[model samples]
Target: MSRTFQRALLGLALLGAITTAAAQQYDYDRQEQWQYPAALAQSPIDIQRGVAIDGDLQEVQSIELRDTVATLRIVDNGHAVEVEAHGPDALIRGRHFELMQFHFHAASEHTIDGESFPLEGHFVFKAQDGRLAVVGVMYVEGEANALAGEVLDALGDASEGEIEREDIAIMLPRDKSYHHYLGSLTTPPLTENVEWYVLDTPVTLSADQIAGFNARYSHNNRKVQPLNDRPLVHFAAH
Candidate 1:
């Protein structure tokens, strides 16, 4: 079979397997036939200006946190803050989605009209309100990434049971342009109503750093959902 045909067949097989697994439960089979609109739910937050997503594209000085809910300390360009993970239990304040352990999705989860890239990172955030906000960042092959190197290095000793503390920066794209839309969690549960923000800018990753992530989560990303009726708000950096 042709390479394209083989890929399509493989994709179909994976879908079938996923469908079978999701069917053994009582929940509706959302994974089998899911779709996302080309846009997002109309929210009060201006899809254009949700927050200031700009700064010198520098790595955070350090990161420190425990796995209990995993409050990650992310510093970027000298700005430091703690990112607490509530697991699937912590409430997302206004929404019903709960926190799922944050992991990296090299290349990216969603693509631009079916175009996949080298790497994407996903910060899965679920809200009790049955809503989810996934922060997606794409990565392009380039210079050595200090921040990514640190995190990847820590993953070596990142204990399973409890969250561990590590100091490293979360580097981001210089142009904070992002695309916001409504979609579903790329992973299991495949729940809908997910508010997705695809940063227009992609970060850099060394060949070695990319290999390190692949060591653990080799292609652990869900295929892009169909943009059904969802609207996507593409924003530019200020």
Candidate 2:
């Protein structure tokens, strides 16, 4: 079979599998598909401006990262395209947290001043004490991203498995300033007590790059949850 044709078939098959699984009792739109949605402390919220900046939102001076390659496995859990990678042993807020994996949701989850982006990338982290933290980066449609391009280049076909791109490099944008808030997991279990740091600056990707991802797992983000009187802080990173 041709490469493009194989990809199309794979996408259809994956979608079919997801549908069949739901037949066993699962809601494609709800987390876990078995329990009621949480009323508070949900993630992927609409990050509004002018919110009171309470505590200090600090970051590590640097997180050890490699360039030549970003070792990540592209996984499709019938939801979103996630990347599993070797973690950079990092720390934040005086606690050491390791980068577990990162994933993308087209049409973004969180919004800024009530506006959503074309894409949202979430970096999930965990500490030894079982604490969780996430760094969210929003992406717009424009020029291609150097680091992201490397990952995209690997998607010649829609094969689902661990995808390790040897040429791709891990990078953090120069504009590290971010908004800090407390939220929960956007997916199943709806786990709360996560420290969320959303990068204030957004990255840009070419139109085709955005379309490529959309074609695969088009819109997988959860709805924007309520802030619920929680305090949000902004870090200038001076």
Candidate 3:
């Protein structure tokens, strides 16, 4: 074999290796092994009610769903089912952040007092200045949710597609009470400075609906991280 041909083969091999590495799936079971920022504000932290400070109703942030109907493009990004849409601006501690996209994680990410839920939905919003705020809604086993069913049906047998959804407001719990804290994205890079508002009240979803999602991406939740002395505040709706 010619020396030039051997070098070409070696270059192709290196390129293939790089591509494979880039496309590697996130290993949730081994997330502790993943590289993250040195910051102490990592997320999916267990919100301990005993340690949480009670705040006034005025302190509660408001999420205004301006558009009841949203055109959402859903995709199963191998890690989680992510939906791309905009609107539903959130007022968090006097700052405004607009919704960018939302995603799902099975077996809730942020636990409450060491208890886990069936599912957790993350509504990610970004400010004009590039800051991020996330609203997490927990789903418990109960009556089936219509919106959840629509999303599940749209995502059926396909990895990526778009679907229009009405009544996006139904996604949020009636009670606006929430646990507020500062944290980073649960996924790697794990960038800090994110504002998290995890709803205190959980919504309901039937067992079969939750099972439908699990059948696709089972066990996508990240283990709850340490609170690390951060002040977690519980804001009451009324």
Candidate 4:
């Protein structure tokens, strides 16, 4: 080949390598190496039921869910299925945080006594000051979940649709008991200072419903991080 042609081939090869590297940067396999601040606090920590201290937060923390129909946009964002909307807000330890969006993770991120569930849903809320509070609910294999079914059907097909407020409200456990801690987001940027409430009571979803999500994004969960010296408090349900 001529000198000009040889140089062109080399340039193309370099560009391809760069693109491939950028794509794999956020891949779950490379998560351990992902960069974050020196806070030493990360998320998806295992909830050691035996070590958690009990507390009563029913009065201070509440989830205000509207009883009206709302439009939600569901997207299969290549990584996980995410539903975006507004209205519901949660009060965490007396601080107000608006529900921004929610998404799913397979095999769960947080575990209870080292046990992983079939599926986990994260309800991300944000305060006006930009602080975040996430409520996590685990799904056990049993009766099919209507909301999960609707979200799965919309994935890779429909984007926008109407859903009842009750459907969203049902995702949260009625008991209101949860394990609270300070952690970071499971996804990249892995921002810290996020308040987490992993509900003690898990909801139910059929085997098929869980499989449907797995088929799209089989494993999108980040490995559990160290609990460090952070306190893990279990808020009792009244």
Candidate 5:
């Protein structure tokens, strides 16, 4: 073989090896149906969830929520325990979005000042105008959470069905100070343009509650993605 041809072949081999290595780093089997690591705007970005930043956020707004008890539907999808919630719609930044669903994660997805909590809950919403927003609540090992117990018991049944909605208002922290940003769903299709609001105050869940979730779905958290020049704002609903 000519020296020039040999060099070209060596370069091609190296390129192929690099590509394979990258593909291996992305767990295709573990990704939620359609998540691609190569996609930008992917979620669970590393965040300073409770800290203040200077001029990083473009705008901040208040949240008006109508918390009421309704029927609760739970889905055992194997990846995570999902709950369907219906109540009076919430007003976010002047847009009304219905509370669609909420799901759980072991440990946590977004890092708060580079620290991960014991568990996380994502309350997802969608507006009539086709806008999406999520409110993230972190959980730490402390006292047992009343609402978490209801979720755990429902999950324990190992069946997918609906039950009377146990009012979870007691679980919501009255203080609304939170970290705000724009990001996509942590799960696949990796849809972009979702607004994220991660509350600074963490709720409590007992050892048993955490264990129950872990027993069902050991770990369903998506790895944190790059922030990549995205803005973060500390918001407290007025």
Candidate 6:
């Protein structure tokens, strides 16, 4: 082969190698920059087509809470539970909208001044105006949660769509001490403008209950995101 031809071929090969390296570098950058809240930035709950009346939210009244229905299912991505709960109305900050659904996250989602916990459950809600408010509860392994314990009793297999009736009402503790912040759902299409209320006092669950739940799902928690230009509000302890 001619020397000139050989040089041209070698240059082309180098260019191809550089291009491949650049593409791989780009992918890594994307992954590194990915944030959980940025993934599920919007509420997953939606009203049924039949329930729509002039596309208004005021026309609606009450929304029933359910365990068998979910519009989105996000398993432990080693980061956060990707939720796509579907329903009609929920109650948030005293406003009645719809109780889309709830999911669990191992090792908690919010941290208190850089302190984290063992688990966190997010009860997502949506208003008619397309706003969101997430209720977060941190859990520690100790005495089993009485309410969670009863519900766990019926979760024989711990699989999705498993429903068990419990007499206890799933209500947050009366203590209003909380950490409020603006963020987004910790899942895909991570949207922003979400209101987060994290209970100051952490709940307790027995080791057995933790094991039972962990058996079904392990390490389904999202990495803590940067506070980033957002302000966190700490409510005075009641």
On TM-score, the candidate that comes out on top is 3
TM-score of every model versus the real structure = 0.55, 0.78, 0.89, 0.85, 0.79, 0.60
Residue 169 CA displacement from its true place in model 3, Å? 1.6
| Model 2: colliding residue pairs | 73-163, 74-163
- lDDT string for model 2 (54-152, tens) is 444344433333333546676655666676766455555556777777788888999999998888998888888889888898888878876566556
> What tens-digit string does per-residue lDDT give for candidate 3 at 1-238?
9999999999999999987664443777777677776658899899999998987555535555556467888888878988888655666666777888888999899999899998999999898999998999999999889888878888899998777655666777878788999999988778899989999999898899999989887788988888899999888776
Query: What lDDT is reached at residue 61 by model 3?
Result: 52
Candidate 1, position 57, lDDT: 33
Report the Cα lDDT for candidate 6.
0.55
* Candidate 6 ranges with C-alpha deviation above 4 Å: 1-91, 161-164, 167-171
lDDT of 5 by residue, 4-74 (tens): 99999999999999876655444435564453545666689777654456432455466666774767888
Residue 189 CA error for candidate 3 (Å)?
Answer: 0.9
The C-alpha lDDT values of all candidates are 0.51, 0.72, 0.84, 0.81, 0.77, 0.55
Query: What does candidate 6's lDDT look like per residue over 60-173, in tens digits?
Result: 322233343333333333333333345534444457656565667665656565566767777777777878877777778776676566445544543333233332224344
Name the lDDT value of residue 145 in candidate 1. Answer: 82
Candidate 4: tens digits of C-alpha lDDT, residues 81-193 = 88886776766677777888899998899999999998899999899999888989999998887777877776645544445443577666688778999999988678899
RMSD in Å for all candidates? 13.0, 7.7, 2.6, 4.0, 10.1, 12.2
- Arrange candidates, best lDDT first: 3, 4, 5, 2, 6, 1
RMSD of 6: 12.2
Clashing pairs in 3: none
Model 4: ten consecutive residues of lowest lDDT: 61-70
Error of 2 at 228 (Å): 0.8
Report the lDDT of model 3 for residue 57: 55
What is the TM-score of candidate 5?
Answer: 0.79
Who wins the lDDT comparison? 3
